[model samples]
Target: MNTLNYLHLDEKRVADVVTALHLLLADFQIHYTNLRGFHWDIKGHGFFVLHSKFEDLYNDTAEKIDEIAERILTLGSVPSNKFSDYLKVARIKEISGVTCGSEAVEHILSTYGHLIGEERKVLDLAAEAGDEVTVSLMSDYLKEQEKMVWMLTAFSSKTCGK
Candidate 1:
């Protein structure tokens, strides 16, 4: 239909996927800020390891943010760009001034779990809409993030809540 992209997906379903992607974009915006804060603020015994690790994580988060926004554009919608908007819609909240490595890692774990959940939601909608590009994007994200969740949980010295 006229509402569909060149990909010829169901317009209504694609709209649902686009909405989900916008929420995911908001989550990543807050997530990126949190990662940056943890990278800059982390102190104590795990500083050397966690500081570098958080830096890596934030870099990855930045890429994800760009990818998500571009994906939203491809889906014929605008990504949410305002931090105030991000704060309002993001399930992952912005945290700051956290100097403890384990505490920050704990937050990271929680955030990753939430992100995976949201990605799955998007993935499902995309699949329903036959938007394989978005589906693949979410699938790759889910795989890597699930691995990060495992590793972060170990670094936090916690059992897998699963």
Candidate 2:
């Protein structure tokens, strides 16, 4: 029996938090899986560079997933991890079948862009509801996602000579 009083979460706030948790988790899973694909099948002039970059990105994404799940638990709610659960909650579409390296980047850029937009929505929702923890988590997460989106998109352009 815990003596401390747990915070009372409003119904709407809880729902929003759950939605954001699931959405962020989905982003993490997609990024992690896509990075693995890029690392394995990168057959370009910049294979080594891309491989190392993807490795770092995937590792960081895995850490964020753990942190996001822990934050959800801190709110006394379970974070969803089942494939079915993710599929239902994730705003990002899964890449079907086989895709080449360059094609993978296309999918990643589109999905990452979508995730950046979704993170903004979650951040706004948290702020409006006065959920400081969720707001802080989202603030940090959004910055990282923005940087990743920039890097991922840069690889799709002429600046990288791709």
Candidate 3:
């Protein structure tokens, strides 16, 4: 039987999983901040509609940030809390002053793309390590994010008209 940091996973596998989780955590942090910016700065003809939508998106991202950190701890590793660390590891960059509704929606879709990609990597790692908890988490996240991506794509199309 393999053991890692008093857990039942192989040490190397756990390390790999922890690394992936940390990367995901960083990506989520960046995405969260970008969503917050969108919520606060978004303006246009759709202000009334997009404002509330951005609020909902940021709130959901905040919850995801907490969930990712908790999962890291569950894997016997510390989650990086520094914004600097997040910037370094995240594929998503900080966005600011995005007032246009279509621009914000486009950025949201791009951020989700990065997030889904990272989650896929985590899913693969978790499955290889037989870590069903992480696997389930990633799977659920992927499903939610993919649907969000689809919705955002439709929203970004010219049909929505900024």
- The segments of candidate 1 whose C-alpha lies over 4 angstroms from its true place after superposition are 1-4, 158-162
lDDT of 1: 0.87
Candidate 2 local lDDT, 1-162, one digit each (tens): 211125545656566776677678877787677677777777767677777776887788789889888877766667887877777767666654433556766776777678677767877887776677777877887788788778777776766433
Clashing pairs in 1: none
State every prediction's TM-score relative to the real structure.
0.92, 0.80, 0.91
lDDT: the better of candidates 2 and 3: 3
Ranking by lDDT: 1, 3, 2
Global lDDT scores for all candidate models:
0.87, 0.72, 0.85
Provide the RMSD of all predictions against the true structure, rounded to 1 decimal: 3.2, 3.2, 2.9
- Top model number, TM-score: 1
TM-score winner, 1 or 2: 1
Model 2, runs deviating above 4 Å: 1-12, 96-101, 159-162
Question: What is the alpha-carbon lDDT for the whole of candidate 2?
Answer: 0.72
lDDT-better candidate, 1 vs 2: 1
